[model samples]
Target: MELSKSGLWGDQGDGTYINPILPGDYSDPDVIGVGSDYYCISSTFHLSPGMIVMHSKDLVNWSSIGHVVDDITQISPKLNYDKMNHHGRGIWAGAIRFHNGKFWVYFCTPDEGFFMSTATNPEGPWEPLQHIWDVAGWDDCCPFWDDDGQGYLATTHFADNYQMHLIKMSNDGKQLLMESDVIFHQYKGSEASKLYKINELYYFFHSEIRVESGNEVRVVMMLRASSLYGPYEEKEILHTHGEELDREPNQGGLVQAPTGEWLFITHHGSCGYLEGRTLSLLPVTWMDGWPIIGEDIDGDGIGEMVWGGKKPIAGYPIVLPNQSDDFKHPKLKHHWEWSHQPRSDKWSLTERPGFLRLHACIPLEIGNFFTVCNVLTQRAMKTAKSEVIVKIDLTGMEDGQEAGICHMGTQYCTLGVCQQGSIKRLKYNDTGTCSDGPIIEGSFLWLKSSWNLDGIHTYAYSLNGEDFQDFGGQYQLNWGFYRGDRVGLYCYNEKTEKGYLDVEWFQYHYLSN
Candidate 1:
């Protein structure tokens, strides 16, 4: 049975797919094709279970297979639930490659230097992240292997005037040899480093900004040289083509399909905070040893975004990312990740069998819902209208505990039940503003949150799961911390750890506009 659909986005089931093939906050995507299978990874930032790994047979349809990092705290203690810090600093953009019969992932934190991990299977058992470089101020990094087995890493250093570098590394992808050469330098804002070799020419694909009409516009730029170290020529390959320059499609990977068609898998550069950066698949055309992404709509010899196109590979079952948890499995679904590293003892699926038990504890910063570490979250669908309802058993709730459904981005809105002494009351909170409803006189309550494409949100509560009464005033979703909006379940107390909530199940669906 179909659990959920990607709404009006994704594959159209007619050999045509629309823009934002994965219509969520799947930003800074890097994809690779191995045999008939393709694997893609995206930046997760501070969200735990770090980098998300997606698998696809047809590049237009994807499934969240696994994550590269299981314990984000392994990178730093600040990422732990006790700290609840690093709002947007954890894992930046990384590169995933099938190298030497293993899948290799390399990424870095703004303050924690560089790290790499390896796994034989894409759905792996990935090895613990291995710290490769201890230098800070670097962002995006991608590895390359030459025909002679020489390994090189292409990265961008923010502290050094936005200079992109090419450094030598061990063939095993573990140690950076420290031999570096500056390839591209000193643009307005240059990043997203991807290295590729095509037809005997070394190609470097990165995104940078250009001042247009006094506004900075992000566009994809390419560099090519006969050797690793330049005399490389640079060209602007992809941009908005005189349209809304801010939402340009940039920062992705180039992979060739089984039919020998080169495709660019990227995210729309800047969108509303409500949607974040969404994934888009574009056709890549090669001209004079350079790759042109999207279409040159205005015939300006540059590429522009295409709203719809023929599927790169046809006849694959349309699959959306996992949503709607039944809590029947022993492990959390791949779609779910904590806002930060969660305290393992604070949550469980096996404890209650068919439910997820969240043991409420005082947040490090009491009363701040964003600081609550046990909030289980996933990307909010980038649709005009979407709703999620969660059935929560409030019998375990104690005084000072608030357990409910919430959507978070720049600002947060929550609707749930709060206990004060002996009274269980329905509460709606938009950021720090709280409004309390009538006392909930039932042992079980269902909380619902819905948002529109404009980012306006509403909250409601139901006693019997049949009818819901709207409670909270309209709230607006805002994007912040380099993230799009996220919706999930949160349970926390301002007082003690004795309070908890048993989540029976969560169901999410996209409504027609």
Candidate 2:
């Protein structure tokens, strides 16, 4: 059902609002307006069914429509677990637009350069990925089709090699005109380029690096010219650091409201250690020839958050779905997705009402939580204190069946119940290894986890629901080198055999104001 809160936090009445419209860890947001509808998608690395597409009428409330990639098998014949080629390399910075009679999406896999897909509708029977531009280190590609039907691809190079470049595309939109490659702009750490035509002049906006602070300073730097390909003049930075409106310097998308108001949408870093990213929107105004961003009538460059303005489109009030699971439904929520191809039979709720049955399967060796098939996780929307309450029945669980709650990614910490002999004991810190915590067997078990904005700090378990003993000291939820961490449930079979854990339900409550 719909969560009580509409946006990130419970809706604040004032125009000033929280930065991220969708609180969860949806990074590198690329938004486009089709007719009167606003559609956006974010990067989903390694997580199968990549590229989540969301719809919103007010630009604040959003709901998932569908995904760009429904099956991973279509991309590759055989997927690997040890070191999957697509792991940590699925959909990155996708740009969606309505062109001609079809809806086109341009995305990058980093290792494979850039690819294009199309559908007659936003939520679609999307075509298989087609290699449009196959060049090393080129990513975050956005294509702009001028009124004259001429197409231009603007993109940035990888950090290890090459630099930002723009090139013209063939009319067929399949290949780039090789000789048309032009270095429109070059900054060592510049990427996520968006090309917009305002007042007859083409403007290019991108984010550059902040070497000193180690944060990617998202500067709305612009370059204007009369021609698409030209001696473009670099203008002053329209948005930069020091101003509270400008968060971490990174890539974002631009859109104009139906009321003729200009707005720039991008993400800001939330937690440096967790690499959590939050979305932010700022207003854009054109002065003289160049555009100024995050400014209002006061001439101050800072953008103030507002609510219920002229409708972006006509629709119902937008509300996000709740993450808490009552186990009343037969299947998991749409918000929960697996890291790889999911085995439907391995998970079920048909046998028992108000309970989720997770059949334990062979555990993999890799520590990357994104590759772990048994893990069920959801994105951490905003920096808040969230707790998960789980009621587990350890009866008949084999010695190898380990069931628990985890804050997982490349790194993780788990607290749950494990069965050994005639007793069931509380378990903790059992990450990447089999043995880590002491056992206290009981018929019924309850597990609880408390996480601050910085990650999970404390975990507790109880034989009876009333008394929870501290199972582990403090554990950090660092997932290797990945940008974000997800929290959810895990049940693994160490026996390389089959067993299952019966979970009563899971309740997640946000305690932060």
Candidate 3:
């Protein structure tokens, strides 16, 4: 649903917008301005169709355009459904840049080394990822291109005492020279590197943990150097100005608007596991050739997070990332992604004409929904209250097949239909524990879940679309797998892959407080 029309967030229509430009998980945001259009990419750890790419015109309104990687198996087989591992891993943090007439994306998995992909257009048929470095224990990588057509990579080695490195690369960004120079090493937990050459000075943006009054806080930092291999100067550019640094805003990229105004698009770096790290756009003020993020509320020469602000570019109709699926299109929406790489042959849109047909597969671990191969999901909105309702046809169900709507975080809860031989029963599965309900004779079921920003989940079901009966226990939403809680659907079998479920439509609404 559109953010403006829904009143969920963004574009207040009074020339100012709220903090979260988009209301959802959307963590570790990296944005770049390609002419009049702005593109943002977020960390999609372990989510198939990894590293979501979004587009915006006014910086306040954004929509999902596509993803960088389609098949995440290129990173590792352990991330597949059979393995069902790497929950909080995969696609750590990445940077996006418009260079050489192509959109280049660079990122590193925590276990696997660095990888990259490129496309001429952001809504893309992106080139397959190129594994540049095969070494491990490195992450949060960004690429830089010099005026002389030279390429360099700035990354952090977390295993090596939080040491940051600068490595030379071919102009093509495919090969990284093993010659590495330690750039910054003084800070603890320093990472999220983005390299930029602004006005003849090299500005390296990153984040590091610091102890203030016995509180560990993550803050945005900057390193300025005259040369690539630098005698560099460091400064803390942005941090929470409150007495307690709870939601520290850090780890994002800087972009210049069409009006020459600069802004930082970042995530609320802490105390946000429930909804995941959400997107925040802050104003950038350049002082002494360094960009200070947000507003200097206390006038301590450091920027604090701004809750509301003037739009970067005015008068753009508000847009939000895609949220619902009608199952009418032949291809899945850009917002939908599998928990891991899906068994593509088992799910089809054309097979049922106007329904999403999920052919049940035998889960690698029976009775465990987490190991289900084809759990299709999209990011759950972090609103005051949000609701998702899905209608599914159980005519295709066979013995031992279960299909329903779900709310997945670190822990998950499902409300659906479970078939036992010839009898169909309503079931509620909460994190592997099951609570069976009454038998259902109807072929169609409407499953719904309502959640609040507190992460409290309430689920219900209906034989008729208008009436719903609450079935599941009140479960708290969790921020697990380094991701925000998700709203999705699932179908799987405990015995064989003979059953299936047809989803007619999935509707999501952001309820007003």
lDDT of 1 by residue, 1-513 (tens): 001132367787889887778778887899999999999999999998999999999998899989999999888888889888789889999999887899999997899899999999989899988988887899999999998988888888988788888888886879988855555555867899999988989988998888755767887899899987878899989875332442678889999998899999998766656778888888999877778898887877788777768998987888866798999998888999898899999999988999999999888897777789889988987675788989999999899899889888878888888899989998888889988899988899888888776678888888899899899899877777788888998999988877889999999888422
lDDT of 2 by residue, 261-331 (tens): 76666665433334355555556667677666555435554332332233333344536536777788865
What's the count of clashing pairs in each model shown?
A: 1, 11, 0
Q: What residue runs in model 1 are displaced by over 4 Å at the alpha carbon? A: 1-7, 180-184, 241-246, 511-513
Model 2 root-mean-square deviation: 4.8
Q: For model 3, what is the alpha-carbon lDDT of residue 322?
A: 64
Residue range 89-171, candidate 3, lDDT tens digits: 88889999988899999999989899999999999999999999888899999999999988888999998888898888876
Poorly placed runs, candidate 3 (over 4 Å):
1-8, 180-186, 241-246, 271-273
lDDT, each prediction: 0.85, 0.65, 0.85
